[model samples]
Structure formats: C-alpha cells, structure tokens
Target: MSWFEYRNQVLCAESVSLAHIAKEVGTPLYCYSTAALKANYEEFVDAFRDRDVLIAYSVKANANQAVIATLSACGAGADVVSGGELQRALAVGVPGSRIVFSGVGKTSEEMSAGVAAQVHQFNLESKTQLESLSEIASKQKVEARVAFRVNPDVDAMTHEKIATGRRTDKFGVPIGEARSLYELARSLPGIEVVGVDLHIGSQLTDLEPFKKAFSRLAELVNALREDGHDIRHIDLGGGLGVRYRDEQPPTVSSYAELVDETLGSLGCQLILEPGRALVADAGILLSRVIETKQSSERVFVIIDAAMNDFLRPALYDAWHPIDPVSEPQPDANRDIVDVVGQVCESGDV
Candidate 1:
C-alpha cells in the first residue's frame, strides 16, 4: 500500500511530515520509513513463501543500524560484502548463520573476522580467494561454507560500472570452469563446498539475463550433483532495479514469479540478495535549499546535502526524484533549476 499522501498539499512519510523530519533531523538527513521497509520485506516474503528461499538483505544499500535491526527483527538475513557489514549485521541480532559474504578483494583480516563470526557462506569470486579462504579456514580449524560466483557471461543490459556477469567483467569465475572450481573446492582440505552464487549486475530491469543465468547455473548444479559434489544452495544475487527515474520496474511479485518459474522443481534452496529494491524507495535524503545562484545560462539550487550524504547522483549519475516541500504555486512561474550539493569537487552531488 502507498504510505505517503499529500496532506494540505505537502507530501508526508507515514503520517510523519517530510518537512518535520527535515527540520527535526536537520537538512542533509536521511529519512527512512520503517513501515515502508517492513512492507517491502513482507511483500517479497509473501511472494516467495512457497519456495525454499532466504531473503538476504544486502547491507550496502543503506547501512543504518535502525534499518538493519528492523529487517533482522522481521526474520531477514544479510548479504554482506565486507567485515564492517558482517559486524553490523551481527551487532543488530542478524545471526552469522544467516549472512552471506560477497566481494572480490577480501583481506586476510576480513576473512579471519568472517570465520570468527561463522558467516553462513562466502560467495567466492576468484581462484586465489578460494585458496586464501581455504588456508584461513585451515588455520582457524573451521569449515568454510563457500559458493563459487559463476560469471554466466550474460549481458545484464545495465550500466558498465554495475554490469558484473559480462565476459569482460571481473566479478565471477567463468561459467565453463565453474564445475572444475567446485571440484577443486570439494577436494580442498579446509573448505566445505555448499552452493553456487552469482550477481549479474545491479539495476537490472529485464528477465532474460536472470533466466539465462539461472538455467546455466542449474545445469552446473546438476552436473556437479551427478559428479559426486554436494551443492545445496543457489544464490541468485539481487540486481533487480527500481523505478528511480521515469522507468517502471517489475513489482516484487512479478520478479519473484520470474525467479520461481526459472528454478522450478530444483532441489536446492534459493537465496535472493535484495538490497536496493527493499530500501531505495523507503528512504530519502532531505536537504535544505542553502541558496539560489543564478548563472548566465541556468539556475542552481544549492542544497546542504553533498556526496557524503547521498552519493548516487554524483557517483553513478543516478537520478533521484526531487521536490520542494514548500514550493510556490505551480502556475506562478517556472525555471529549470539544477539541484546540486555542497561538495567541493566536480563529481560531488
């Protein structure tokens, strides 16, 4: 259900006025809707209720402790990329057994920390990392549950920085060599090979890439099972995009339908690592209009929020819907204002 509604011609978040939040928390503050977050989580859970799925909330989306704690209280797991995220997840009562770690360059300290925390699984990206993890596990005398992230080499049809599963990207092991890697992990002394994982890319809007990736992953899973390796989990790492601009994204129900159909009757457990889809629309950064500067060709609305506060716009040239809380009448006058932030760099928000 839609939470925000115009009250007296001003948009509010869950009966809490956005203007009030901006004033209370101060400008450049991030306001999150606990209801929205909970609703998004419940939406996905309900859609995939029949499947053996674990919704690992990706912590990188918005790592606020309150947000993490809220999701944890709702029986959601975490998909962490670094030791910091792992610690944050555990700090908020998200059990280590429910955490899946994914990143390309994991340091020795990070591995030791994750091993200490007893994370559920590690989405291994490279052969070198697999060996390192095995060594760390051997030294710690703990069995490391691992899933080799296979790069299906499918184009996710997203921006370059976010596209991960493409052949030119360095995110995962090539699909052709995934089985061999699984065998190698099985033969390793300290590693316990559990499953296969993949993250094609972020902000993915279409289903062809997902379908192709899942089919390829299913083939490898079957082959591995036939060849005497025990693969039990399939992590289709979340890259489902949202309607940040004017584009429309598949609702959580439709997205789950695609996934459910793709892995029909597969014996392995399904794990979805959703981050942006759950939190993006639930939270928004509010900044006060610091000043209005006029230019020869345009006008700029300099706000207090900077790259430090919300970097998506600057980092990815991402589009975030902006609206003035107390705006003048629409028919009064119109001017194209470039809403910007206070960072001291060209790439700053």
Candidate 2:
C-alpha cells in the first residue's frame, strides 16, 4: 500500500485512480505502475554501477508489452525462457545481443531461433541440449555464446516448485560435471563457452544461499580459467524475492556487495534476471466481490477473478494482499471469511 496507496480514500496507482480504470477498461483487470517498474529497474542498475552488469528483466514474471518496452527503453536487457518471449523481446526493440535465452527445456526450433537471433547467451541445462544447440548454431553459421547452468546443489530454502539449482532438480549440470562439459563445449564446432550460470530458487529471503552458490561459482570460474576456458561472464540467475507480505529479502546494494566479493575477482561481466522482484510489486490484479455466502463451516466471499487470471495463490500458496478500492468505514462490520475466486477447483483459494 505504500507504493499503491489510498489517496483520499481511493486506491490509486501513482496518481491515477483504480475506479476510473475499471470504468474505462472494465473490472477483473490487471494494472501496473510504470513508475514502479522503472524505479525498481533503476535501483538494481544503480547498485551495480561500479561493475559491468546486465540487468535482464525476467519476462516470465510479467510479459506485458509495455513493461518490456519500458525496461528496454531504459537500456535493460531481457532474460526470456521461450520462443514467444524471445519474439516479444525483439518486437520491443531488444537486440538479440541483449537477450539471454534461459529455461531447462528449449525446443530445437527455439534454439534455431535463438541462433538466428544471435542471443547474448544460451543457458544450457543438459548434454542433449548442448548437441542440439551445437548442430543448430553450426547449421545457422553462428557461434552460440553459452553458459552451463551449474547446479551448486545449494538449497535456497524457498518454495520447492520454483527451486532450480539442486542436485535432485532437473536443472543445470552438477558443479562436479560442469568442467568436463566446458571441455566438451570447447570441442563442439559452434558452441562457445563464454560464461557460468546458476539459479538456486525463487522468493528467497536469505542471502546465505546466494553466498554459498556464488562462492562455489567463483571457485568453478577459477578452475575453468585454469583449464583455458574463455569464461567472460557469470549469469547468477536471479531469484531475489519481493515483499508480497512480510518477507525481508536482501536489498540490491547488499546483494551487489556479495557479487563484488565473489565474482569481481574473476573479471567476468555479471548478468542478473530478476523476475518477481521487478514486477510483482509494480502490478496488481483488480477484481470485484461477486457475492457472499455463509456456511456452517465457513463464510465464503467470492470474487469475480478466477484462478486462471492469477494462478500464484493456488499454485504456490502465495499470499497477495487484497485491499478495497475504497477505504472501509471505521464502523464497518468486521468478519473473518475465506476470500476466494470463482474457479470450480476446491483449491482455488
């Protein structure tokens, strides 16, 4: 509410009232603050001003055209995970050199598109993918600048669904296996090993996991250099959480300090792909209270928005604060009720 505040008893995004938006664009709407997105992007950029850094906005969080264009205009790159996102980044004037194609499963067509685009980096997750990209890059007459999404196996202690860098998870190569893969990549005709990458998890409130993972990455970088790999960049895949509720995640400045301490000595360009930290707070879903039903077990306050519109609540047990556009009266009746969407699923809370 501090950012999207109640001005004169009405919720406003910056200075524009939400009620006016609903009247113009209809309800069950998604609203975002350009100012918030710009500020968040700038804050992260300012933190790493002392070093060579690329702040690639993770498009998975919010693929809204305006959001992508806003960041792109500000000289921010993109970290896209799919072909559609890659095209979106391009349509918004993001050069392929500024986009990093990530994700565990990328189709051959996607790899070909990435090759055609000559993206900044491909975060390869498996041997099969390595061969696939090599074939495509060679056929397309392009050297794919790539990085091994190294699994440090450090538990980020966040939600299991979003955690990527673990021994058990089907993500990046294990730290033990990365060096050999780098050698294999060296032998490949069209694969250029340019960087190391790792993403432990999302919604991380602790910095210890980052310190552990980055420390391991630094060690791996030294080993890679000793082995004559021209490692020029490090993609410390971003999962710095935002305060959807009361979680106190690390600030950009503190995280920058850890980056400087760990990878600064390696002299590699730094890349970060922040998702929720950039977009979650900058936008909100606006819905209407449809009806209220009372049962012996519970009171259900049904809303017009469904699980399909915003799935994080049911999908991740995520909590996003819902507030009335108009402030409640001091004497308004206080009731304990289950606020829910109109989805048919029982877990659509």
Candidate 3:
C-alpha cells in the first residue's frame, strides 16, 4: 500500500527511480510522491463522505509548499499553529475560512493576523490567550469563532514527548475547568463559542485512548449545550499513527467508525487534523552512502544525510528502514552494521 517500491532491480517512487532522482538532484534530498499524497487525502475524504467533516491537514507535519498545495487541490483544509503556517496555507490557495489557528503561545500580532484573515476557528489553550484574542477581535470589530482545546487527561499511550492530553501535559485547558472557562468565554466580547477541541497526541496506534478521550468530549459537549452554548463543531486534533515499523495503525474507516460511535448523535461538524498519517509514507529522504568504516568490533555505514536533515531518529530514537537504490540479490550476504550519519556526534547514529 505504498507508492515507494522496488521495480526490477532498482527502488522507485511511483515509477520514478530513486537512483535517477539522486543522480540528478544530488544526495540528501527529500522526494515526495504526488500520487501518494493525493491518494492519502482522497482516502480520508472517502471515509468521511457520509458525515459532515473537514479534513484539516496539519501543516507542521510536512510544510513543503508542494505537499500543501497537492493536499489543497484534493479539497483538504489546513490546521495551522503559527502565523507563518497560516500564511503558507493561504499562499497555497487554502481559503481563510478553511484554516483553523491553533497554538498554546499566540502573540498579539499572530492573533491580529488570524483575525484579519477571518480564520475558521481559533483553538484557544489558555484563558489569558483567550482574553488576548477577544481584545484583538473586538478591536478589529469582528467576532472570532473559538474552541477550547480541553485536555481530557486520557493517556494517548504514545511517545512521552508527543503526548498532549495527559493532565500534566501543557497543551490544553483541563477538562474539569472547561465548563467554567466556557462560561467566561460566553461573557467575553467578540468571541463565539462554536465548538470544542481535543488533541491527545501524535502517532497514536490504538483506539482505546481515542475512545476514552472522545467519550469525555461527548460529555463536555452535552454539558456545554445545557449551559446554552451552541456547540456547532468538534475539532478532534489528529494523532492517528501510520506504519512506521511494525505498527499496524488502525484503518481510516475504523477511525471514522470510532468517531461515529462516540459523537455521531451530537449533530456537529467534525474536524480532523491529520499530518503524519497523510504525508509520512508519501515522502522519503533519499540519501547516498558516503563511506563505510570498519572498527575492531563493529562496522558503520555512514550516509550523506545527517541528524540535522532528519532529526526524528536522533530526537526520539525513531526507526526508519534503509535500503540501497540497487536491489541486492536474494542470496546476498548481510552484515550487522550500524547505519550512521556524518554529524560528528556520538548520538549521530
């Protein structure tokens, strides 16, 4: 189910040989498959066709202009966390009405820019930030549609660095304190409480955590409705995992079913922010082997790509399969050598 495959005796990305691309573009380059990107976006659209949903591709995943534009052409909106990202999405022809501004730290200038652009919604994280947005929106004489990203305290069971829904995580307002904050937002000027947002974490493989978090979200939405707030949309920030190693991530159809089972009765628009799931497999960092070093006890295959070029392995000990552009014979000899980068650091492997 991947666009990158080995054809004959060479590796290819949707029929274009990786070896040819490296020969032309040089080493340490990123190659993305346009076909794969469109396919991934279309899969999400097809899965949610029956429901009122907005698939906002998270810009932070892969901010390449070509990647964003390709998704935009496939009817994908954007979930941006900064003013620059918002501009990128807009420059790529994503309408302001289709962009959701989200971040914990929003400067006055960023808020002003978002307000001026008439963004679809602002996923506010803190009361002070919410107050700042209200003041800015009031000054601009426009009501800013807002949603409180609530921390459901449900563990996403993902990596510690990526988890954002836990009680200790500094991503969103605590769920217990959300109702009171909603009450305050109701009284604030130039603010419209249109929805609730929940983002647990990134690279989530299982559905139990999502189910628990979404069930909590459902309760909060009902309570907010009883409090006279028109909860029109639910922004379930994306954290769906993909096959990175042995991880068998849930299918998009199954994820859609989970959403329907949890919040289908609410009759609100659903917003999903999927970043890694859509683009991770569609692109590859094509690096050439610089040299091979043999020590007394071990061997190292140094690559032209460094940690600065691809930091996930160094940052999170993430694993990515490496293969030569020229296919080795089925009975070729194998070596237990460490694949390293020329970063001149001990942790460069």
Number of the top candidate by lDDT?
3
Query: What tens-digit string does per-residue lDDT give for candidate 3 at 1-349?
Result: 8898999999999999999999898989999999999999998998899999989999999999999999999989999999899999999899988999999888999999999999999999999988999999999999999999999999999999999999999999999999999999999999999999999999999999999999999999999999999999999999999998899899999999999999999999999999998999999999988889999999999989889999998899999998888999989999899988988897888
Quote the RMSD, in angstroms, for model 2: 1.1
lDDT score of residue 119 within candidate 1: 88
Q: Write the per-residue lDDT of candidate 2 for residues 1-349, one digit (tens) a residue.
A: 3568889999999998999998899879899888888899888989999889998999998899999999899888999999999999999899998999998889999989999988999999989999999999898787999998999999999998988777999888999989999999999989999999999988899899999999999999999999999999999989998887788889989999999987788888999999888887888899889999999999999998889998988898988788999988899998898988888998888
Error at 268, model 3, angstroms: 0.1
Candidate 2 TM-score to native: 0.98
Worst lDDT run of 10 residues, candidate 2, spans 1-10
**Total backbone collisions for each predicted model:** 0, 0, 0
TM-score of 3: 0.98
* Per-residue lDDT of candidate 1, residues 1-58 (tens digit): 6566667777788888888887677777777889999999998899899888889999
The total number of steric clashes, by the backbone 3 Å criterion, in model 1 comes to: 0
Please give the distance, in angstroms, between residue 123's alpha carbon in candidate 1 and its true position after superposition.
Answer: 1.0
Task: Using TM-score as the measure, name the better of candidate 1 and candidate 2.
Answer: 2
User: What shift in Å separates residue 149 of candidate 3 from its native position after superposition?
Assistant: 0.3
Look at candidate 3 and tell me the lDDT of residue 334.
94
Model 3 alpha-carbon miss at residue 342, Å? 1.8
- Candidate 2's displacement at residue 222, Å, is 0.5
